[model samples]
Target chain A: MRLTTARRSTLFAGLAIASVAVLTACGTASGGGDSGEEATELGDYEGSVSILAWPGYVEDGSNDPSVDWVSAFEEETGCMVESKTYGTSDEAFSLMKTGDYDVVAASGDASLRLVAAGEVAPVNTDLLKNYDGIFDFLKMQSWNSVDGVSYGIPHGYGANLLMYNTDVFPDGLTSWSAVFDDAAANSGKVTAYDSPIYIADAAVYLMATQPELGIENPYALDETQLAAAVELLKAQRQHIGEYWSDYLKEIQAFETGDSVVGTTWQVIQNSITTGNTEVVLPDEGTTGWSDTWMISSQAKSPNCAYAWLDYIASPEANAQATAYFGEAPSSQAACEFRDDCEAYHAGDADYASQIWYWSTPIADCLDGRTDVECTDYAAWTTAWQEIKG
Target chain B: MSSAATPHVTAGVPQPRDTPARRISVFLSQHARVRLGLLLTAPLFWLGLVYVVALAALLITAFWTVDSFTGQVRTEFTLDNIITVVTGSLYQTVTLRTVGVALLVTVIDIAIALPVAFFMAKVAGPRLQRILVIAVLMPLWASYLVKAYAWRSVLAEGGVVDWMTAPFGGSSPGYGLPAVVITLSYLWLPYVILPIYAGLERVPDSLLEASSDLGAKTWRTMGSVVMPMLWPSIIAASIFSFSLSLGDYITVNIVGGANQLLGNLVYTNVGAANNLPLASAIALIPVAIMIVYLTAARRSGALENL
Candidate 1:
């Protein structure tokens, strides 16, 4: 059947419209652009906020009688916090997809994935009164922001410190060489973190000691850099007594004198029962995690989510939460409420700037060097298996 | 038979109407095939829909890949995951180490269980047998994690074993492969012993008497008569210990020092890394091994005896 020019044009218009609709549908699945939902407007609380957090982030004195910030938040805002603690960031990332949680205490490795998947939204700093009090060093970073839009309120931060027994290292150790190069002095007594993310620690050590390696970002390593890191780990493996993923295991090992020195978190040193151990930010800059309180994009209690975020970020609450977790509180005023702020350098932007925050490596270079492809998290996982082998 | 030929039950009762339930029962009773179909419907549905189908779906997923960056499952089929699992040296080493531990644990349990099971079945009086069986089963009442943690403390430096052996100038082996094997053997010993005890109880005293009447010694009778009869139960017990130890990631993590097993690899890929395809591939290793083991067991007529 023959058609007129006008009819043919009408058919082409329909075809073009369908193609654009299909392309946009594809775009929304993964590369969600600008998640069109508006941030919640301030209003009366929604009565509840279901939270997914790391342990001690949303305490109500159940874990320890003194650690109780949720009760105060509940009393003041009337937004009761029903929280579930996850062991790893991966578990938190998976849980966030259910959209059941109102807010998540997400680490840097998981925050970006939540953003990329549109499982979380760009948090409105204006809604959170305490957002301004957050240290400037923790704001608008790579993992917690996308295209300069903040995704969450900074909660707290901590470095992976070089912790050593006081008696074993009476001379006082400085630098990661205590765990890598000089670790042989206490062979069969050294420990390290167990996760594949520990690969970044090796890279951080290399950045200080091996200038010839030309490694810029601890997370953004190419094949050769990853191999070098793996080689160093293999050498370190000889001296390793154990590799600990949980703070409890590390504490037990230290108390029993099975582990004399290793990579550790500040919280682990506090948990040690018998040993007089001290943690330090060694001469080599370290890799660490900065957690943010992110609201779910599909939050059922948006108002309460905002209220809880603001309340948790307040000076007193942030201090209690961070001190309990043994980290530097994000709020500048939290230092006054907590005594160990000097040890953590709570408001010291210089020390915070020195840390290479834990970000999941992607093929696109996180350091913005695009000439060669960077090794991603999958590669790190593979290299880690080999290192352990 | 026709309704006209149906027999009446009682004279005083009113003529019973052919209710649907009555009709179904009547029909099922007449046709053997229908009766079997009706009887098997619930169990067959459960095993087919829940058990077999789920396993088949998981097996199908072994060939798929994941977008490692986004952590989304990609339905598109690929063999790269399977190839990597087969070729990777880490997978090879961990598989070997896991099998070695499982074998050692099985052998140790059998060696220990054989005599204990004999005592429980043949030597112990009825009262002592009951107490011995209760002793073996009591550990299982406690949580698996609690027992594993107990072993952790027992093996820790300056702990129970170290203190007990101080007089002999020996100490605990600390935590590693040896500790893993010892702990697994201790945990699965009861599983091994129960089956052997049951098998031993089935052995008639009259048969042993006949063997002895033919001038056969006790050792010869045990080897020739008791062992052959007990073979199937021993195989069943081994399958229990082997599979349980093969998939144990938690116990190893608790006591294993700087060492990993096949279970740890599968677990990390599935949970921590969010790479399900790789995890599925790694999971298939033990599944294939188990299939082969079951087949071998079947060839030895274990299926009938078990």
Candidate 2:
């Protein structure tokens, strides 16, 4: 049954041709869906408003015994609310694209892509009465706006910090390099945010050491910049005991001392501190991501969506949610309760100066790359998969 | 013997050709009730129609492409989506690893299961067989996710394994590969055991006694008499274990750590990255492999039966 060389070559040629035909057929089929941008029809209001939100964004209806945000919103605006919690921003984007969701709380990274895809609509800021109270910085942020059309209202934000088990490193953590570069001390005991977007951290680390890599802004990565960052992560992955995405798991990893040092969100740090860990703002400054409440283009009830956005961004709601969720407040008026908010706020004059907020990379942005010239979300995703692999 | 011979003779005889009315009477007499029953049942008719057509439609949708930026299913033809399944190095690695792990799990199941199944069918009392069946089914009754997470703590640095091995200086117990293999085998063992038990149950006691009467050794008698009878069950169980493990993502993801499988890739791509097209494409690789394996296994079983 052994095939001759010529026969094997002929068989391979046939297979190659058949594979090409299948790919060509797929290409044609994919193009067919691109032709029509059928106008989104509204007024499916009576059924429900399917919202994809962060896990803690919705109160646990059974345990918390609070008037659920959805129930309260439904009572106020009369649009029934149906919500599903998402573990990551990437997951929310996938679900929202199905046209089954009416609203989503997209983060700074995902909001633009959603707008570009027309999955989410540009919020009429005027319709949102409480939009005025939202911090000016969050309102016109580059990721949330495209061509002066704002797509989302400010929601929640938290800084990514260097967290360590207080028991393991009582000396107090100071730098990102201690975890990324100096691994002998913390070998197999470090974890990081298991995200491709964490290339920003690598860029942060490289900005200090490999100055020639020319990485200034972590998010604004060029192909060359990305290649160097990818190499850094490939090295870091070797040191990581686990690349954790879940906050609860991160806490568990920290509490068990399995992960000694990690790049963590403030909320996760807060959770871990309840155990034996302490978080430190790195000497090199820290990076943060802001979450935004965006309305879907296919929203069943715009009035209700606007109401919910306004209610959430109001002084009382913003202050309460920020205190509860362990993120910075989204409202200016909420800062009047500065003493109460200080524990959660990363923006106290000393802390504010230390944290660099996330800004979308656009053409001529200070992150050292032009918008169109920089790597977009798709490239980041593909690179992330490759990096993890 | 005369009556049985007469019946065979009647069956062998051909009926004479007849007129249209007579033919109608003959066909009606043979199949009228069964045809009427099929026609009268709307649910069965619909089930048959949907099973054939709807499930095919679902499988076809996996070929559909989703826009990376927008996350829209581009109903257009594009093999660009399937690039990973066809050519990606990581996917190839995962695919091979999944197959290897699945084969290992199947073999482990067959080794442990055959004896247990034999004991239940041939050796155990009726009550004992029932009790053993209950014990085997107990693991399947627990929540699958709960079972997987339970293995995590056991594999953790200072968890159960480390504690036990500490006296022997097995410091910093590594549970990555070992944990995944053990957990997956545990999860799908029932898939093998149940089928093998059923197959062994089908073997007549007469066959085993005949083999023994012919002065065959215990091992030889079991092999010559039992294995051939159980070939179909072994094939069926292999198909179950192989297919289940091939497509599994959760247990492996929780246990495999950096050693990613096709399931983990599909999960991260589909859930974490929102890259459905790529996920769907990667999903098809295991599916294609499964189809090939199952078909080959089925054919071999049929040949063995003949």
- lDDT tens readout by residue for model 2, B236-255: 88888888888887786666
lDDT of each: 0.86, 0.73
Whole-structure CA lDDT of model 2 = 0.73
The count of residue-pair clashes in candidate 2 stands at 13
Instruction: For model 2 chain A, give the 10-residue run with minimal summed lDDT.
Output: A30-39
Task: State which candidate has the highest lDDT.
Answer: 1
> Considering only N, C-alpha and C atoms within 3 Å, which residue pairs clash in candidate 1?
none
Q: A-chain TM-score per prediction?
A: 0.88, 0.82
Cα DockQ of the candidate 1 complex? 0.22
RMSD of candidates 1 onward, in order: 8.9, 7.9
lDDT of 1 by residue, A137-172 (tens): 888999788888988999999999999989988887
What docking grade does candidate 1 earn?
Answer: incorrect
Q: List residue ranges in candidate 1 displaced over 4 A.
A: A1-40, B1-9, B14-38
